[model samples]
Target chain A: MKTLETTLRSLRESGRKALVPYVVAGATPDWTHHVEAAVLGGADAVEIGIPFSDPMMDGVVIQEAGLRALERGTTFESICQELESLETEIPLVAMTYYNIFLHYGLRRTAGRLHDVGVSGAIVPDLSLEESDEWRAASGDSDIATIFLVAPSTSRTRMRTVAGLSQGFLYASARMAVTGAASDQGEGERVVSELRRVSDIPTYVGIGVSTPAQAHTTAVFSDGVIVGSALVKIILQGASPTDVESFVRSFRTALD
Target chain B: MDEINAMGQPDHRGHFGGFGGRFVPEALMPACVELEEAFRDAWSDEEFVALYHRTLREFAGRPTPVTPLPRLSQRLGLRIFAKREDLAHTGSHKINNVIGQTLLTQRMGKTRVIAETGAGQHGVATATAAARLGLGCTVFMGEVDTKRQELNVFRMELLGATVVPVTSGSKTLKDAVNEAMREWVTCVADTHYCLGSVMGPHPFPWMVREFQRVIGAEAAWQLKELGVDVPDAVVACVGGGSNAAGVFAGFAETAAQLYGVEAAGGAAVTSGSPGVLHGMRSLILQDEFGQVEEAHSISAGLDYPGIGPEHAHLADTGRATYVAVGDDEVIGAMRLLSESEGIIPALETAHAVAWMVREAGGRLPTGSTVLLNLSGRGDKDVAQVRAMLMEES
Candidate 1:
């Protein structure tokens, strides 16, 4: 399995903008196929969401998708078991609220994710000041603890987040959760702030939905993370081929 | 006594003995950090303190009397006194927290405030504060709660606040809170999230408790004035445990034993384990998979699956005890208070009354002097209680 930092850093060093697609692990019975579709769609890394019952930070679309996924009996253990069947060599990052991991036992979760070939995690609700224990435990298992930087973040904290963030820095495009957007959002500005702080593999997310938005974000962000837009497609019963096409559009825009 | 220890504050970084900490999204970390700094500065500034007290005094009605519950005390064979927070403006102790947050909102130059409410006491209080201070108010409540609490929705609207019905998740207080956090992120630059309870990330659990400690502080002095120094027990109902924490704050150093009553179905401290929710690590009612379960209660205010972080810590260290009462008992307790003392307590507050009735001679001594925090008026719950009575007959 590819390590998150090695793959993303190599992509950045080679001047190729990265494209990461996100999908809920159990949004569909064939959700793993959707992950496979992203691989086929030219994704450099994939973020898999372990659906949580109360996703405090997600917008409506993702929240609905999570409810659907959880109704189908998706759990942290269930999601990890399914990842074993995945054939992707690219680094896989799991995203969810902090409670899921804190409840699952941090070291056990980190070790299990590593065993399943997962490279990093995006526990959005875990702030930098409270991430020390998780970071150390995840780091011991070679599982990167990804941190997010927002437009509202002060420069000093941005520097702190960048210094502690392993694998990559998840740069929020705007001060909003994962959802749809009409304009390019704050992707460019936040990415620039992150760029000034350090040369970490920063990916702009939260509202990078459309192909044009992805294209714009890629111009400044080292990577563009397309989440809700792709999850919305899968939740709407898009076939693996259709899901591939959706991700391919963002991939094409990045290229 | 030194006031700081009397009303405990969290660590400089907001750790309430390993429970309360900032666990919000990075997008809100700056806002949380800013709130912490502002709270510390304002809480210490005599002018801000004076203004907070003045608003509570002249505007919201402070120093709510500590009344003796003679009839119920006679029946239960216990010496009982009730701290009448129900007499405060807006009919609940929730007004105290909102008044403080709304004032801080203006001080921070924020022009709008957003809040989450379950049964709507907090929302009504926030709307009231916002209207008084001339700030925009948007309250997020669960779609289900909005239907059941239409009057509160109308009340907020009448107060010039927009009430957005949250339709996601369980469509209840838990989901309303989720929706509120999502909304806060989008407007954190110009809005304050006026959290209702002593929950949420750092400063909130600590901050709200500080605002509410006035309840305990006043009752402590009032009891002394009544020649009752240091009651045998101090009791209050626990939702996110603001009232309990507040009252406990005044008597934590006292010899009085503190009891926080929880609805049996929503007894986080009584039956829950350590977990994270609403941006704090506390005792949360969750399934085996760590998914938080929906709390059930007759009162909308106490229908939460978690207790406040400080409550969790207090429960851990044995500084205070937590107990649970049934909905049926809460209803009976409400009626007993109404007929016995001409005081109708909110269903949420009746949990404490119910526990006192059951434990007065069982767990507690028959003649012990007990102080109960009457956290809210029963006017909002009378209709629900009426329907329940009719159904039972």
Candidate 2:
């Protein structure tokens, strides 16, 4: 599997803005198909969620998606098994809270993800200071560890997060939870600040749902991550066609 | 204590013997780290400790007398002294920790405070302390709890704190905690999350325990003054286990036994499996998939699915014994205490009383003195108890 940095760097060289889509791994019975659909729809990479019971960063939409996924018996182990069976060209980074990794044993989880051809992890709850163990584990397994920087982040801390982050710096578009509307100007400023601090590729996530929002975010950062909007589609049991169409729209917008 | 011991517990990362760690989102980590530093700095500082005691003594009415339950003790044929925490201002032991945290909030230069409440005791305490300290306060309550404890909602509002009725998952204390943590993340710059319980990520479990240790310290000292040695057993009800942990801290290094009574329907320590919930790795009621399950109890305070990591550590090492008591037993204990000693304990605290009553002759020695931490007054629960009795009739 391609590393996240390799994927983003290639996209950067092509002068093509990255279009990363997100889908919860076991949120629906046909969850894997949604990823394939996004891939078919021209996604550079995908963020797959390992559903957690208490998703503090997520808003109602993603939380409901998590509930549905968990009810369908989605677990880290199960999701890993399914992802292992998949054959995707681009990196599929796992997004989840720290408890899942902590509970599963950090080294074991990272090793399992690596074995499954997973490229990286975005543990939103694990900050730089608390990420030493996870980072070391990821390092041993060659799985990139991504860290998030919010609009509220201090410049010094932003530099610290950028230094610790491996694959890319995830700049949260706004202060609110996922699914909230992203303020374009505020988000662009955060992305610009992130670019000034880090040489790593930056990706804006949280609240970049619509084609316009995703395009606007891509204009500022290396790319944009669309989660809750895609989650809503899967929650409604939409066809892979619907998922592809959604991603294709973003792809068209970015082009 | 040296910085080594301080840093050791909930160590640099907040683990209490494989429990308690920072399990919050990255957005909240900086704040959690800052809070931990401030807590450590304040804990060792003589001035902070002195100010905390002064606030407790002069403002919140600490050094509450330890009253012997002569009538009930004689009837049960076991000596029992009730640590009258209910007599403290705000009518519960909740005020102690709230005061300490509010002071810490000010010390951190944060001018606003937020807290989660189950039964509204913590909400009232947080609101009361915030009002007294001239800090903005917002207390999140589960929508269901607002209906169950409407008076507390009013009490918080009267104290100038906004009570947000959370309409989220479970519609109870757990949801309130979720919402409070979310809000704290958005407003971490100038607000302190005055966590009502000793649960949650690092610093919270350790910080809350330090704030509440005064309960045991005073009780131990008071018992000594009364010419009574350590009680055979120190009993306190455990919800998030603040009172139990506090009282246990006093008797932790002693030969005295510690008994923690949890509401039977929500007995996390006794019935739960080891899992992470509410930012701490403690014993939690969860499914095999590690998804937290909803806990049930007539006493809202005890309706939490998780206990403090310290309590889990204490139970694991056999330093303390935890038992679950039914709602009927809590009601019976409440009535028994009210009739026998004219002290109506809160439904939450009644669980401890019920435990003592059930094990009076069985586990405890016939003449052994058992110190019960009367963690709160029952005035808020009179209506609930009356309704239950009415339903029974």
Candidate 3:
């Protein structure tokens, strides 16, 4: 399977914007199928989230989805195993916190993630200064360590993060978590600033829910990450087909 | 004088029982090492010690009395004692560590102290320290925690500290820590990371414990004066393990059985194994491949994936026995303590009181004494406690 870095580079070269879909592991009994369905629906990458008990940054929709996933006994290892069993070669990224990664030794986690065909990880809780262990452990393991840039990120820090980050920069659309409204103009300005400072491809996430929002973000960035909106679709009683159909709509919107 | 470990030799590489070590990125290593050296040098200096004691006595209201809980003792069938840290400045033991760290930050020529808080106790305490020392202070807290701890945010702001509401992942204490750590990395030149507990990487666990050791040290002196050479047991709740570590450190060489009670939502020691968490090696509730599992105690303070490195070391070395208490137990104990002792402990501390009641089985000998470190008062938890009580009723 191609790594996230390789896939991102390929996408950038091909003039093709990336499509990353986030799925809460075990949100339902058939969450595995949903992941497979997202892949089939033309997702360029998949971000699997391990549900937490007190998810402070998540909105009501994402929090509820996480709770439902946790209720179904979804665990970090279980999700990794699930990803390993998949036959598809789509690049996988785990979006989680430092605590989870810390609970798992960085080297061991990097190895296990590599074994399961994961190409990258985006730990929202890990600082660049605190990421050395992870970076070193994952250096030879073929997993890209992704970092985030917020609207409030300073230029110097942005450059530093961009320099350290592999794969792509997870540019937050606003100062809030997923499922919130995007400050379109502010997001654009931050994206432009980040583009000027960063050498890596940047993808805007955290509140781009609609086709128009995705297309709007695509104009300035290499990709747009849609999480809460997609999760909301599933949570709002949408069927798997509906989710795939919605994702296709987003893919077309970006294209 | 007894041979004191002056160079802090035991803290080499900052491992307290394979629990505390600087497992962070190389970028953060230099800063951590510098801070460790500064803390050691400052703490060892007689002048610094004098100033620390002065601040504790005048500003923080130190030497919090060891109150005999007659009603609680009578009800529990054991002589129960309370080390009233809640009476300290800002109403919690959090200030004890914050004051010491803030002073160290100033001595290190740092302009700012950045911290993460859950119940806002630490934030308020940090703000107090910043105001007293006239330094810039910034605190990162989860959005949800900010809402629950709104008054605390205002209080921090009132004290001239900027309370940045972290809107990222599960915006609680853990996420707040993430944001603070991130800020610290970027602003390491001018900032000091004021960790609230005895958790996190090497020097943090050791330093915070050293500052908080006053709790245990005073308790020991007081307990001896109260005609007890050694208590049968000492109990304290384990969030990031500061209070418990402070009290436990006093009884480490003694025969007193030390009980470190963890929130049962996801007990790091009981339900987890040795792993890296928050840039330290400690017992963590993690997956098979070592991803930290989310913790879920009713007490926000105890809802952490890992314990302090020293606590992990203590647990491993069998110096301290670790136990777990559930939400219901903690809440029940909260009411029991309030009703019996007229002291409402922070829900985090209630975990320890709850364990004593449950594990004691009403069989503690009448003469057997138990010293429970009442880490903090329950003012911050009144609303939540009331809601829980109303629900139960």
Candidate 4:
């Protein structure tokens, strides 16, 4: 399987920005359908959120989605088993809180994710200063570790995070949690600042909902990650076709 | 075990025997690092220590007197002294920790403070401290808590702090914490999360405990003056365990037995599984898959799914004995104390009183001396208690 770095590098070479759409695993029993739709909509990568009861980084929309997923008996083992059947070619990155890995045995969970076709992982709660154990566990499985750079991040810390992140640097468009509207100027400035510090492929997430916002964010970064917006659509009882069309619009805009 | 004790807690990476660590999101990392550094510097500074005590003495009322509950002690056949933390300015033990944290917030050059409150004592204390310290303050309370604790909500607003009503996820303390942390992520640059208890991440459990330790220190000196070298047992109610941890820290190495009383409806220490929640790995009410479970209690303050990590560590090491008291028992105990000693204890603190009522006669040795922490007054709980009493009648 190609690594996340290779895919982002390829997208850059092709003169196209990447589209990474996020959907919560087990949001419904057929949650895998959302991943298939995002991939079919021309997404270069996908982020599958493993539901946690207390997601401090998430807004109301994502929190509701996770609650629903948990009510449907979604477990990490169930998600991994379901991922093995996913036929998408794009790299799938698992986005979760650090406790999930700590509970599941980090090294063991990393190997399981690798076996099930997950190419990378993003633990928003695991800061760069506290990620040594996570990095070591995931490194053995050749699973790339993605780190986030926020507006509140210092320049020195930004350099450290950028240097350590294996796949790509996640640039949070705003200081707020996920699902709020992105400020175009702030989004552009954060991406520009990230670009100035490192040449690593940067994807701006958190409140990049609309095609216009995605387009504005993509102009300053290598890619854009849409999470709460897509999760909202899915939670609002949208069909798989609706999800595909929604993702396709962003793909077209990015193109 | 000896080597672990010699190394002395948290072991540099902030693990209280696999209970506490920095499990917050990446956005809060720099803020956490900054807060930890600022705490280390200010905590050791003589000026900071002197000022903190001076404020307590002058503004918040320190060295709260210990009252001997002779009637209740005679009934139970055991001698008891109540440390009167409920007599503090804000009517609870919460003010001590807030005074320290609000000062540290100023020291860190942050001008705003955010906190989550369950029973509203912490909210009232934070609002009071922020007003005194001349800083902006915001308090998040669950929608359910707001309805039950409406007077406290109004009190916080009247004290010049904004109270945000969170309507998510069971609408209780845990949800309030979730909302507060979400708000802190965005405003961490100039805002400090004035955590109400000895829980969450590294520096919090340690820092809050230190601020609260003065309670035990005061109690010990007062007890010694009364010619009591060491009480048979030192007891306090546990709700996220700030007061308990504070009081326990004083008697940790002493011969006094440490006892923590948990609400039967929310006995995380006695009936919970060890798992990670709210940035700490501690005993929590979680299912097999690690999803946090909602805890239930008539006392909103004790209605939480998780306890402080230090309490969990103490439980594991047998340094403390944890027990549970039911709602009915607490209500009866509250009435007994009020009728006998002219003290209406907060329902959270009444849990400890209830445990003593149930176990003092048979379980404890005759003539045993017990030091119980009266964590808070019952003024805020009068409306809720009245309703509960009406229901019982």
Q: In terms of DockQ, which candidate is strongest? A: 1
Cα displacement (angstroms), candidate 1, residue B260, comes to 0.2
DockQ of each: 0.90, 0.47, 0.10, 0.65
Model 4 chain B: worst 10 consecutive residues (lDDT sum): B1-10
Which ten residues in a row are the worst by lDDT in model 1 chain A? A1-10
**Candidates 1 and 3: which is better by DockQ?**
1
In order of appearance, the predictions have TM-scores of 0.98, 0.92, 0.68, 0.94
- Best first by TM-score, ranked: 1, 4, 2, 3
Better of 2 and 4 by DockQ: 4
Please identify model 2 stretches exceeding 4 Å from their true place.
A77-87, A102-117, A129-142, A152-160, A185-197, A233-238, B1-9
Put down candidate 4 lDDT per residue, B153-266, tens digits, no spaces: 999999999999998887889999999999998889899999999999888998898899889888988999988988999989998999998888777868888999999878
After aligning candidate 1 to the native by TM-score, how far in Å is the CA of A75 from where it should be?
Answer: 0.7
What 10-residue stretch in candidate 2 chain B is worst by lDDT?
A: B1-10
Determine which window of 10 residues in candidate 3 chain B has minimal summed lDDT. Answer: B1-10
Clash pairs (backbone) in predicted model 2: A125-B25, A125-B26, B10-B14, B10-B15
Tell me, by lDDT, which candidate is best. 1
**Residue pairs with backbone overlap in model 1:** none
Off by over 4 Å in 3: A1-255, B1-11, B287-291, B361-364
What lDDT tens digits, residue by residue, belong to model 1 across residues B212-323? 9899989999999999999999999999999898899989998899999999999998789888898998989999998999999988888999989999888888889999
> What is the Å distance of residue B132 in model 4 from its true position?
2.0
Q: Relative to the true structure, how large is the alpha-carbon lDDT of every model?
A: 0.90, 0.86, 0.81, 0.88
Per-model C-alpha RMSD: 1.3, 2.8, 7.2, 2.7
